[model samples]
Target: MARHLDLEEQEQLDELKHFWNQYGNLITWILIVIFGSVAAWNGWQYWQRRQAVQASFLYDEVERAAVGGDAARVEQAFKDIKDKFGRTTYAQQAGLLAGRVLAETGKADAAKSALQWVASDASDEGLQAVAKLRLAGLLVQAKDFDGALKQLTSGVPREFEPLAADRRGDIYNLQGNKDQAKLEYMKAWQGFPADSQYRPLVEVKLTALGVDVQTLKPAGEPAKS
Candidate 1:
């Protein structure tokens, strides 16, 4: 009985050896790939966190400069954030802040430049829409009507569409296209909700354009006869 047990153990050991010989290299390679992928993912997450931390610091500089009304300082800090962390949310917010400060300080060109960058490169659609609106306003002030229209029409997020239409109406009015202006203003007036403060704003514009505010309805409502 002892000799038989010894033989069975020997056979079992040999079978285990044979299985390892058949699959060892494949299992080793699979484990190496899994470990390598995990390492790469961890490295990527660390890098992104580091970038956010650095960007937040730089954005604080921009905010301080903007609060101080220092257009030049705001411009410089915004440039730094955009250059180093352009893909970060901090960069987008910095651009908007820098542009507003620059505009308030009468640096129209520089303000336009900052806003244009946000409109063109921002990842957030809302940010891009705001940038475009501000940029369009500056362009209108500069009498670049066509350029203003281009920015307003290029693309506006759904929530901003009413504002964009209002801006288009303003542009059309400025260009002496009263009919088109009224049309755009009506679109704006219809876009807003009944109780929205912004809806009243558009209604005022529509009133100026000779539209009866009471006759206007919410976007999907039928016209009263």
Candidate 2:
């Protein structure tokens, strides 16, 4: 029985060696790839965390400068944050903050630059739309109606569609295109939620354009209580 057991163990050992001889390189490469992927993922996660921490510090500086109403300081800090962490959420916030403060301080060109960067490059679609809307507002204030209209063209995301339509309506109205203005305002009014406070504002614009919003409600759907 001892001899039989020894023979059995030797067979198992021989089978293992044969399997290894056939596929050893493949197994080794597979393990290397799996471990390499895990290491790469871990490294990427660590890098993202580190970047977020550093970006947050700079964003705090931006907030402080904004609170103090020091536009120049806000712009400089925003530049630093954006340069170092352009892919971070904190950079998007800094851009918006710096844009507003700079615009308020009468630095229109710098404000546009910041807002334009956010509009063009933000990973968050909502932030991108917000930047475009704000940039369009700045262009409008500068009497660059064509530029404002161009900025607001499409890509505003589904939720921001109403605001974009309203902006376009305003521009059309300014340009004395009453028909187009009415069309855009109607779109804005229809897109607004019943619970939205801003709906009334859009309604006012629609009314000025001689639209009867009551007629525009979906058939058989009751207005909000």
Candidate 3:
């Protein structure tokens, strides 16, 4: 019985060796690929976290420079953020803040450059809309009405439509087109929500154009000719 048991064990060992000889290299490669993927994923996560932390620090530098009225520092910090972490949210926000400070400091071209970068390159649609709106305002100030109109013509997020219309109205009013201005102002007035603080301001604009808000149809109703 002992001999018989030994023979059975020998046969089992031989079968195991045959299986390993057939599948060992494939199992080894599969395990290597799995472990390599896990390591790569962990490394990618670490890199993303590190990039965000660095970008945040750079953004804080921009904010500090802006608050101190140091345009040079603001530009330098913003450049660094854009160069190294342009894909990050902090970088996008830094661009907007830098643009505001640059514009306030009389660096109109620099401000426009920063705003244009955000308008063109920002991944977030809302941020892009804000950049376009602010850029349009700057162009209006420069009497570049055509440029401003071009900026406004680009698609904006839905929530910004009323403001865009109002801006267009301002441009038309400046150009002595009272008819078109009034129409655009009416569109803005109608587009504003009932509880919006901006609605009253639009109402004021309409009143200036000799249109009575009370006489106009309520929001969501078609306007009378």
Candidate 4:
């Protein structure tokens, strides 16, 4: 009976060895891949957090320079932020702030350059829209009317549509196209909600065009006869 039990144990051992030989390499590789992926994900999250913290510090530097009215310092800090963290939200905010400071300091060309970079390269759609709108205003001030029109022609986010229409109306008025200007002003007036402060501004535009804001209905709404 003892000899028989020994033979049974040897048979079980041999089967276990055969199973390991068949699948050992594949099982080891699967575990390695799963653990490696988990480690890589954790590392990526840590890196992104570190980058955001660093970028935020750089943005604060740009803001301080801007508030101090030190254009040179603002420019240098903004340059560093853009070079190191251009993909971060802090970089985009810095671009907008820098553009404003540069424009206030009579650096129109530099302001346009900064705004153009944000308009062209910002990852956020709303930020891009704001950049484009500001760039269009700058172009208008420079009397680059055609260029201003080109800037306004690009798609803006929905909340900005009314503002864009109003700007287009201003451009048309400048170009002596009163009829088109009134049409755009009408669109702008209709686009805003009744209680919006901006709606009253649009009303002023329409009033200047001999169109009574009280007489026009919102777009797509049926007019009462």
Tens-digit lDDT string for candidate 4 (53-167): 9999999999999989999898899899999999999999999999999999998998898899999999998898899889999999999999988888787888888888899
Ranking by lDDT: 1, 2, 3, 4
| TM-score between model 1 and native | 0.94
Runs of candidate 2 with Cα error greater than 4 angstroms are: 218-225
lDDT tens digits, residues 32-147, model 2? 99999999999999999999999999999999999999988998999999999999999998999899999999999999999999999999999999999999999999999998
Local accuracy by lDDT, each model: 0.93, 0.92, 0.92, 0.90
Query: Estimated TM-score per prediction?
Result: 0.94, 0.94, 0.85, 0.90
State the lDDT of candidate 1 residue by residue for 17-37, as single tens digits.
Answer: 999999999999999999999
lDDT of 3: 0.92
- Which candidate do you rate higher for TM-score, 2 or 4? 2
- List candidate 3 segments past 4 Å from native: 1-30, 215-219, 222-225
**Predicted structure 2: clash tally:** 0
Of candidates 4 and 3, the better by TM-score: 4
Error of 1 at 166 (Å): 1.0
Better candidate number, 1 or 4, judged by TM-score = 1
